[model samples]
Each structure stands twice: as structure tokens, then as C-alpha cells.
Target: MTAATAPTGLGEAHTVYLDHLADADEYAATDLAIGLLDAGVPAERVLLDLVAPAQAEVGERWARNEWSVAQEHAATHISEQVVAAVSAHARPDPTNGRVVVACMDGEWHALPPRLVAEVLRLRGWQVTFLGASVPAAHLVSYLHRYDADAVALACALPMRLPYAHQMIEACRRSDVPVVVGGRGFGADGRWARRLGVAWAPDAPSAAELIADERALRRVPPGQLAHLADDEYASLVRRRSELIDGALAELRERVPAARAYTAAQLDATVSDLGHIVDFLAAAVYVDDASMFTEFVQWLVEILGSRGVPVGAIALPLEHFGAVLRDFPRAARALALGRAALPGVAR
Candidate 1:
């Protein structure tokens, strides 16, 4: 679509890029981005307004089961490539200071932060985009070696708040305030405030925060303050036992699971382990909703894989039986199980 003939400005660009992304056509996607630039669209507008909306829709398509796992990955990869292609044409920034961007450990969603990195660079910030699943120790170590004006942490899942908290406190201990984004911290970053750190809702806001000359001196949180009981710690110690028990029960109950190839079984086992870890984290934070929400999302993911949502109920029920004595664990498992289709609340 030509700039003048297009019905709207950035809106049309979003449509064009989305069409190519859905088809996993990298060159078309890159060409569309360049076309927008030729049409006089600002680089930041193309990155945030056009590409961001398209990427959000790609995620929604996956959530609605309109795209397979591989399709989602391919689309996201193409989007990443498109961002790089657009950045290649961006003018160099001379005034922006160094800033580090990273995702919380266990947060596999890197696209959002990567978008922020490029946007910040376009806005004249020297960005070090540390891709997905960065461990807190590694991040802390990196901070020691590099001097950054601010660090931006991305967390896309509520199940990751515990680790996000850890990373925030770690940064605080070193007197480096953190700027947090992504859905995991809630819409307004309520969790980030609870952990006593700065929260930026998006890339522009984050860049604005980083650019502000005012000092950011957030107080570090006390150690182990969020945890109440040894139950979470105990559960973590028994994590292997829990996953093994749940896997064995699923193998007996799910014929499809029993007939799976070794690789598939390994994936299933890993999924179960993640559930256990998230449950333990929920108990540690005294929130059942985190575990319950993860289950609801996991149900959709499994549904995309052709697995019945109700099959997940068995494992939740099994977890309830195994952790019956722990009040938080029991409630978390019950809420998760109840969230499944046809399960009682």
C-alpha cells in the first residue's frame, strides 16, 4: 500500500507487516518495514506502533489456537528479523547512555524486551540486549562488569514474579535500581512496587525513565521477607519426588501420554516439573492466583497441542493429594484443578 493511497498511516503498515508475519515471509516483512520508512514513517513509529501491534496479534493467534507452536516461533523469529532489518537503517545515537535489558530467569518471552532495546537505541540509548532466560547470578555479574544508567527487566508470566523479585533485590543490593516491564508484573506494575523497584509499562516509558537525570535510589528488600513457611522450601527439596509421582499417575491414566515417544515424554516431564516449581513459588508468595492463572494459560497451550484440558485435572488432583498437608499448596492445586473444564470450583 502506497503512503498517500493508504486508508490510514501506521495502521496500514501494521496490516501489511502482519500479513507477511503470518505467512512467515521474512523478506516481505522486512520490505514492508522499509516501505513504511520510505513513506516517511518514523523508525520508532514503525518499531513500536506497527511491529508491536503485529507481534501482539501473533501471540493472540497462538493463544486462540489458530497457530501451532512452530508457527508461533517462526512468526516471532521473523518479527525479530524485521526489527533487525529496520534497525540497520536507523541513524546512530550520540547522546544516549548505556542501559542493560534482560528477561527474568524462566521468562522465555524475549521479543518484548528486544523491541524495547531497539526502540531505546532509536531513541538514542546505548542498549545491551541480553536475550531471554537470564539467570539472576549472571545478570548481577554482568552489572558488575558494565556501568549502566539503568537496567530493564522483562517478565511475561505471573509465575515468574518470584524470580523477578530476586533479581530486583539483587540489583538493589548493588545500589542499581531496576526498571521492570511485561505482563508478569501486572498491568500497572503493582508487583514491581511491592518489591520496591521502578516500573515502566512500555519501551518509551522505560527509555524516558532511563533518560531522566533524577537519581533512582530504591531501598533493597529484607531477605526472605516474602516467604512465610518452610513449606515452599520443603516442596522444592521434594520437587523430584513430586514430578515423578505426578508423571507416574499421568502415565497410568493418560494412554496417549503412555504411548508417547521418549522425546515427548521428556517434554511432558519437564512441563510437570515447571508446574511444580511454579506451585512452589506461588506458595512462597502466598498467592493462589499465580498458580491458577498459569494453569489456565497452560490449558490453552496443551489444547493447541491437541491435548484435552481435562487431562490436566488429573495432575492437579494428584498434586492436591500429595501436598494435602500444606494449606497453600492444597489451595493452589485445588484452584488450578477447578479452573479446568468441567471441574468443580
Candidate 2:
């Protein structure tokens, strides 16, 4: 279906515009962004109020089974195009100083940081938008060479938090203040605080925090101190081992899985790997809730796709067996087991 240039008046056609996005029409989305500017709507408002909401709705659609992964990706691609159109129209004033925006390594979720980067640019910061999955070493070198006023990191998945922590620490060594954001930080940014860096709840707030003199100048804290009993490190080291054993056991116990097609089997293995990675991150950060929340979310996603939650839950029991001596992993596994539907404790 064709969508006209979005209502030039501020926010009048939000729902209609979102419908166009759901249809995977990039032209409709881009026309809306450009028309908003033509109507004298501020660039950032077009981005934050219009594009951002539609982008979020795309994710919600995928989460609810209304849209497949491909549809979600296509919608997001349209949103990115819209953001670019708006960004190109808004010239940077550079009065707010320099900032670096990057998505965490192993994190393919680039849209969040892309939004932040555009927001910073609109607010007159000399923002170097580093795109997605920038390696820690490259990021550190960039900070050292250009000497940014602050670094804003985006992480969407919980599994990326461990590597994000590494990036945060690397920035600290270069004396660049780091501001962490996105779902990976949780609702309150409790993990960001624990990792000993600043947190921004969203793009607008990230701009505000960087503009505020007091929050801007504070030096990033030194590396988070290590725990006395760091079972986390050991768990991380044996991650492949855990996934290998868990998959073998899952195939043995689940008769349906044994008869599955190659694609189905690959998806199952990938899901298990994600579980192991998330649990490792949880243990690395010494936080039980992250793993628990991830497990709950995974089960819900699986159930939505008509996959039995039991398939996901079974790994928890298996993980618990192998990681019996590891306190954090063991706790997370138990939480997963308890939260899974129809699973007996």
C-alpha cells in the first residue's frame, strides 16, 4: 500500500505513518521525515517523536509474532533511511563539543546508537557516529587520537553486556567518560552503574546529560574491582564445553528434536549458545537478575514461535549439572528452570 508524505503538522499521523512502516515501504517513511522538515518541524522532533516510536513499534511487532524477523529488519532499515534523511538536513553547529557514539562489539543492534548520534549532532556536538560492533581496540585508539568529550555506548541484547563492560573499561584507560544506554542496561541502568560509568535512558536524555557541565566533566571511574571468588572467569573459559554438553543432552531427551530438520536443529543450537553466553555475562557481572530476565524473555519468544518452552528450559537443568560448583551460573540456571512453563523444580 502507498503512503503519502506524512502529515506535516507535528505528530498528527503517527499511527498512519507506523502502518506504512509495517508494510516495509521505505519511501513512505523517508517522505514523512522530509515533509516534517519541510513543514518547519524541528529535525530532532521528527527523529525522536516520529522515527523513534515507529522503530520501537517494529520491535514490539516482532516480539508479538505480528511480524517476522525479516519484516522487522526491513522496517528498521526504513527507519535508518529516515534518520539519515533528517540527519543530512540538520547541519551540526559543534558548539556542544565532541562525542563518540558506538554500539558494543558482538552487538548488531545499531539503531539505538544511530539515534543517539543524530540527537547529539542535532544538539551541536561534534559526534563521530562509529556505526555498529566497533572493536574495543579500535574504539580506544579513536578516543585517544581525537580526544572526545564523552563516549556513548549502545547495547540492546543482555548477552553483549560482558563485552560492553570491556569497552567501558578500555575507555576509562583513555580518560574518556562513557555513557551507556539501551535495553542491555535494564530499566534503571543498574548494570551500567555497577560497571562504574554513566547511563542515559534515551537519546534526548543522553544529549541533556552531555550538555550538563557537571555530568559531562566527571572522569570515568577506574576498572570495576574483581571479586575474590571469580567463578565467572572460569565459566567464561568453558562456555563452548557447556554448550556442547547441553546440546547433546537436549537431543537425547527431546524426541521431536531428534527428528527435526537441519534448519530447526541449527536454530536450537544457536538458541542454546545465546543462553550460555547470557549466563556467562550474568556471572561475569555477578548479577542473577540479568540471566533470569533473559531466560524469561527467551521462553516467551520461544512460546510465541510455537516452540515449547521446555526446549529452552531443558538447558537450564543441563547447565546446572555442569556448573554445579559455580555459584552465579548455578543460581541463574535454577531461576531459568523455575521460570520455565510446566517445568518441575
Best by lDDT: 2
lDDT of 1 by residue, 1-345 (tens): 454544347776677777788888898788778887876888888888988888899999988889877988999999889889888987666476788999999899999999999988988888899999999999989989998778889998776777888888787676676788998876877666666677889888988887763634543443356466688778889999999999989988877778999998888898888799889877766778878888988988888878877667877888899899999899999888878886776
Every model's TM-score? 0.89, 0.93
**Which residue ranges in model 1 land beyond 4 Å of their true spot?**
1-8, 213-228, 254-256
Candidate 2 TM-score versus the reference: 0.93
Write one digit per residue (lDDT tens) for candidate 2, span 293-328: 988888778888888877877788889988899877
How many Å off is the CA of 24 in candidate 1? Answer: 2.3
- Give candidate 1's error at residue 87 in angstroms: 2.1
Candidate 1 lDDT score relative to the true structure:
0.82
Q: Which residue pairs clash within candidate 1?
A: none
